[model samples]
Target: MERMEHTSNADLRAAADTVLARLVGDVSGTARLREDQWRAIEALVADRRRALVVQRTGWGKSAVYFVATSLLRAQGSGPTVIVSPLLALMRNQVEAAARAGIHARTINSSNTEEWEDVQDEIAAGAVDVLLVSPERLNNPDFRDQVLPRLAAATGLLVVDEAHCISDWGHDFRPDYRRLRTMLADLPPGVPVLATTATANARVTADVAEQLGTGGSSDALVLRGPLDRDSLSLGVLRLSDAAHRMAWLAEHLDELPGSGIIYTLTVAAAEEVTAFLRQRGHTVASYTGKTENADRQQAEEDLLANKVKALVATSALGMGFDKPDLGFVVHLGSPSSPIAYYQQVGRAGRGVEHAEVLLLPGKEDEAIWEYFASLAFPSEELVRRTLDILAHAEKPLSLPALEPLVELRRSRLESMLKVLDVDGAVKRVKGGWIATGQPWTYDAERYAWVARQRKAEQRAMREYASTTDCRMEFLQRQLDDEAAKPCGRCDNCAGPRFTADMSEEALDAARVDLGRAGVDVEPRRMWPTGLPAIGVDLKGRLPAGEQAAPGRALGRLSDIGWGNRLRPMLAAQAPDGPVPDDVAKAVVGVLADWAKGPGGWAGGVQDPQPRPVGVVIVASRTRPQLIHSLGARIAEVGRLPLLGAVEYTGEVYPGPRSNSAQRLKALDGALTVPPALASALAEAQGPVLLVDDYTETGWTLAVAARMLRRSGAQGVLPLVLAVQG
Candidate 1:
């Protein structure tokens, strides 16, 4: 039962081969090692006892473990261990290593019967190397079933997607933090090697820190040439959704061979796949929803050239390797430019001049905003969770946490997982143990926090409607480089680059409406009758001056100010006050009738006479108003500042009460003329028709041309306010 040992690298490799022969008899596999990979392999074998390999995704990272284990087995060192994110990946690595004539096995949740066998093999040093998902390693059964048995077990912990260890890294996993705990429980001197597809220098350094391995710079950092001369990358923004699909259709026929059309949703993937197939393109749909058998079939079909393209969700790329893929067509705006670039990277894997076309349209932002709003946890749920975790005596299981909290199962799980990563909870053998719970919120404080959480949700919603470059906007807020536009993003592709609020941009020849770069003759938001150094919205009537500096915005609260434009602040009059003449007439009649009570004719002084104008500037809103309103000057009796009033409060006059419902029956002399839309229609150049919301964009489309913008113009309407 004694294990043999060898001091020399050659002897170790020879012994490793003999050990592998015991399991996978003396087979040899291809060793097409890149120069850098070969160098890392040498460093792995030449080392005294332990080695680490940190490499990119496709650089054959799994090879380091397989090849090194071969050399180590020859040295008479026991089994090597690898832990990673996916079950399929572990299985693939283990199978490939076996085919290479090295004994390898995988233990994970997916395989029930073989799991015990694999663990048993690792225990007896029957397997040269063992592969398992991180979950399997974290199992307490690991210590009981296997760890104590291998006398020469050289534990080689390989973490795939290694960037997850750092909070600042692109991908962070709560389970990753617990990895340090797992490592500590292992025998000392075990080398942990972590690898990922994409990570920056900061993330790279953190990987080493998280692993607690002061392993030598012999700690490998190998990035094969980014000089993917075969890949031709290009960013594109389309004319519209229809046009974008047209481009896809044209390209499918025009391209060379296998392709990937990555859509933003499962619905999109299915729809596109069906549409393309109907058009005789031989397409296949592959998404997370697709069954396992179907997914593998789709992948195989694409690889065999039976399918021209695989229409898949974001889930598809990381799961499989389709090397000969010819092009990658992006179907929508990605959450970040980084994601866009990474998804596009799937193409041109095996050939020269592989094309990646980005398809972006205006509606993509709505999709993105919807996606962004999905991040917040319900406030009530988070509050209850903090309370539950705070008082916990032991690790809380999903079943226990569910009944103790008042939230949907999925959201609570995610928040608890996040709390775990934040060091608030530690995962134990059974469930989770709280570490530093902050659950002492009073009722009022919880209410206040809830309000703030809701506000933050609104802020994130508003962020999507921002007129800034989408990439630069996200980068600035998230990465602290807000204005640093990724030239590859749609905003950078906009006709105008400087979309910020600079005095220069205010007077620039062209201003980016950001998403909408329409060719508006030039106009600023202005109330009527204001010329004080203000420029009238260009392409409008001669006197259309810009909005005044001191002018305030108002909203319509009540139907008192009949046919009058509402501003943000209180109106000069609230109740409908009668004009002097109308008041005099009513008073005179009442006085005559009251001269003799009998002459009153049961009228009793005309019931306090209604105000002359029921002009209601609707103002009933939560909290106090922000500013005051003043005399709104009018152009042809049209108040351009009227749109600003819509911001004061949400208008739900009634679901059935359309904009013009029962207007003629109102007892008012002023007719609500539709002159404003007409005036906007006549404006030349590019004109930005301001509105708070653009649900159907009927308002924008109706007012489109008068804004002097065409469907084909270099500009489009810029809508601001809360996202729709």
Candidate 2:
């Protein structure tokens, strides 16, 4: 450590205590920093050294930075710049700094209107700290214009959630990798600090190595036990989704003060939220789909204990601070123990004890596979993207590039960011441009990452089934040297919760799960730059030719019907007649659709007219399934069976393709045969357009337009499953 003889150790300790008291708002004057916290702060403030503190949540990681900022500012240093990952964390840190009479400002996507003013304040030395998201670090204007100036002047640099910088970490983000550029630009003697509640030995080593970049000395590493004394962990293995839902509805009220209930998917989150609310609990759903304003309100409500709980997906994880959060229950297991540890750490932070439970389901693996497919694209795709950017006359926006590549928009953007960090591509004013740098595709490294992911999945499985202490198992996974049986968990102390639930709750859960039918809204507008791909589609879809809002039996991401639909819809599944149970469920969906709000018989502003006939879309993979379903619906609804729309082109590309490519492959794929045209021309009202599945919704849209142009008055789409 770099030592300074100008100040005595005793005097430095006294100053640190005074700052802690102000930061914590401790009027009692008894607040003092722990020995390790003091060591970390002293290294940054007095020794001017980089440090990585791997401590558990609520271990006062923020306090170390804030106290150091206070001491540094007193010596006439520039403001501390925190590269935080989440908005919630930044807000909490800003509030905590205010208690110490420190002026803090934030620049993020939500406050773009105020960036100019915040920048002015920083220039005038009016702010003590400035928080920015990791994404902001690589934004073209910020990186090329504002970043160098800020780095040259920064007093102290803090990387919150530093694990994200490591490729091995559970939450690795490409944007965090851009920090290396700023790190290299920092003026001499600018101390740096990286902090996280999660990160195993490998991740720790990786982050520490990065911290040493552009510096002459290595970072001082301080790691502690990854155990929470207030957490009583356990696992409850149930038969199926119904049992799990029943258990939650019965025991939600029994969980200590208000807390969070996590789901694996947005659909599942919404489903759980609705089920709990129906069970007389005041709960709201929080997911990536939630509006920004609503997300803020939900956070505030949870902070003030206004709601019973928030049923959420992984989007609610990281940087969400609730000192007294009572419990955290996962409806399904996360793929990694490191990730689960970070999430459960949110609880038991400020309380004497809190409940932690995992209700693992058989379907969790399917969800894991779905997410795994979205990992880094193959080498071929990456090379194609680079080649396109290299030869382009000018910068190409994401939309303009979409038609040229087969990857989804979000995945494409993420790949570009990683390329930018590696110096192969540059994001400019209009879009992205190639830098002509020689880049090698590291096949070995990518393969190792894939293997590591599988290993984590296996570890999570072992975590759920192990008979040993749950806390010890998790600690060991994190490579904590202090791993040991906590003696406070359910396995160590015997069960504190019963597997048995009230029969009434089970029956209610069944009824709710048995309810079918979800809205499959029609795609109204064409994807941008479609004309560039040789297809003429552009702008809003003609209203008269579009299909009416549609309905489906369930989402493949749901806990109820999803369980039944997944296996039947698998690509490897046999193409046989529809199963008896699924046929009944389809009938149930139609029945519910007719009577529910917006249905043919329900009260609404503009109810859809009852269907006149049924038309089936030919499916190469599930021809029998589609034919049987369409015939059954026609028989039950007492409507004639309109002829099918024949497939007259190359084999379908399936659901894995992106919007532009899917539309291109489907442009001249299907045709309306003469018999189908005649039947549609004779139909009196809207037709029930049936398909086995809908992923991108392009197939249905195109087919609906064909039927409408041929002669059907209106079309209402029905599908077995809606892929997210």
Candidate 3:
């Protein structure tokens, strides 16, 4: 203990070496700190100054923080507080800390039961390092009651994945911006360390500026080249999603080692995982929707090399540490090159050669656009949100406030966090309350953010098409000062992977993709606060008034039949008769629907009757398609073609807004003609309600209600596609 105290103020290099030896155990006998790692440790421990370290994934950024924490604690400083963004990261850090003879603990969403014990450890000075997620910084109980004490006593502050602290970053989180308050309140001498593997010049500058204690000049920034020698980057332009899947099915075993297969959506992740399983590959699906216990199991499986891969979304990103991951493959391109770089960096961390492949698809841009729409809300919407809270009599939780605001639930939560950072609102025991503080909406800043996102999207497209070195392209995108062409990537050294799949594999993939039929579950409950929107409906719809579980030929976002259905249902497609092939596919779907697990053949005591008649929903844009489909279905089934439900009001033009607004627009838009009502009154069984596509399902719900009121036994929705 005496020797450790003496070494704290001695030569900083010697102290860092001592700590590094403890950090790496016997490995440190042959290992030495990189010059920049030593510099960051010195800045934090010796100089007691803030620093930001931007290096590639395997560059020992964690060593800088762990070494600094050891030095500070040896001198009797308080515990280090690490603000990490992911649970997987925190768990890995805790385990890593234990190897250095440091006692570490974490408080996060996953372990509320342990929080009290953790707090007791902190109070007892038994915890050497403490890690908490960024969201925990804004949690009402932690922020109001515990954060102040932790901030003042923190020996060192480390922000992992610090790119998230800047809005300029591709994956920014509003919760991270709340760190400004924590940074401001920290005791004067507590040093700060921020680290990330992915950040361009703009994001680095933004984060460095935020790290400023008294002035911007106080923060030292250390950035290095973003090249990963172990990763051989390549891009394969697939004809469509099915081709991408076929390529994977044909070549997955050829990849080097156990690794990750990334998909852009949870559904795609699950679909790909299922397909690979069918192909006899061991894989698991990981996504935001994955259960916590399952996520832990998946991570464990990947680390143990039990599964060949985990088909995952970005939820498996950042903070997952595996030293020898073999490869990374993307089913579709991400919207930003920086984000793609971060994900691929997860690979080749502790190996000689790991493959990185991107299979760009045509639907990638549309998916990008859909996500881009969820950026910070407009000033009008933000202002309206605050007004609602201000006028409320009590704190309002997210779901309780969701209907009052037109923004979606996720977007609304993000906006509330931003407002919390701006001091316009506060999250309390029950929910959020207006702080009654004046705030200004930064219109220029938001516009600049939007423009930045658009630029990133464009850069991603260039990345997919560029004829240059893929590694160099990614390095340059991150503004790496020493960016250079690697001699290993596909472009720099010619193609290392072939874009060929066996005809047998292609046939199997085609059959898989061609197999279609997605159950469209009826909207069971009405959106809450419908009365506020001037709709008489509220709560769950009665069983008699609801549409039965319906069927769509395919999901508009699916990788399968969606490719064929998209153009046909697109707004610009000219209305025409149902094509023969699509008609045949629909018939196949109906046949399977009658026998599938969730359908009438599921062995229910009471079976559903077959459709006795067909009713076409009025369509202004695709009248020819709807009428043709209804007529063809009736002809095929030998059923009566009931008169079409006529549009009694102005055309709805199909939901361009939220659910409430959509319902309002289509409230009285359709009515059953007297002939149709009379025919329905005479029908002995269910009738088929046909439309080109269903977006919100509110139209089907409303139409079904009318049919049921007209004495039809039941209404079954049959549509070409369902939009997600």
TM-score of 2: 0.97
TM-score of each: 0.55, 0.97, 0.95
Best by lDDT: 2
Query: Order of candidates by lDDT, top first?
Result: 2, 3, 1
Give one digit per residue, the lDDT tens place, for model 1 in 1-724.
2444546655654544443344333445322455665555556556532333443334566666666666656556667776666644554566677665667777666676787677667667778777666555435565445544432365456666676666544345555665665566656555555666555454556677777544455355554433344544444554444445545655576766788888776645765676566556899998878887787688778878898888987777543555577878777656554345446556665576566556654545545544544343555756666667677776677655654553435556656666665556655677766777554324564355345434434443334445555444433333232245445433444432111233332222111111111111223322222221132222232222321111001112111110012221113334332234323322333233324222223435433221111111222331122111111111211323222222112333211111112111111311212443343333322222333222222233323322222211212232211111
Error of 2 at 311 (Å): 1.0
lDDT of 3 by residue, 1-724 (tens): 2224534444667767766777777564655688889889888888889998899999999889998888888878899999999999998999888877778999998899999999998998998899999999999999988899899889999999999988888888989988898999998888999999999998888888877732567678889889999999999987877788989998999998899999887767877898889989999999999999999999999999999999999999999999899999999889999999999999999999999999988878877877898888988989998999999999998877876887777788988998998899999999999999999999999899999889989999999899998898889889987989999998999887888998887887888888878888887798776676677888888999999889999887767777788778776789899999999989888888877654555625456787889998988888888898999888987889997877785555466346665676677788999999999998878998888888878889889989999988998999999986
The candidate scoring highest on TM-score is 2
User: Each model's C-alpha lDDT?
Assistant: 0.47, 0.90, 0.87
Ranking by TM-score: 2, 3, 1
Off by over 4 Å in 1: 1-32, 48-57, 135-154, 213-220, 223-225, 373-383, 390-408, 421-423, 426-724
Point out where model 2 deviates above 4 Å. Answer: 1-6, 213-218, 596-598, 601-604
Model 3 whole-model lDDT (C-alpha atoms): 0.87
Give the backbone clash total of model 2.
0
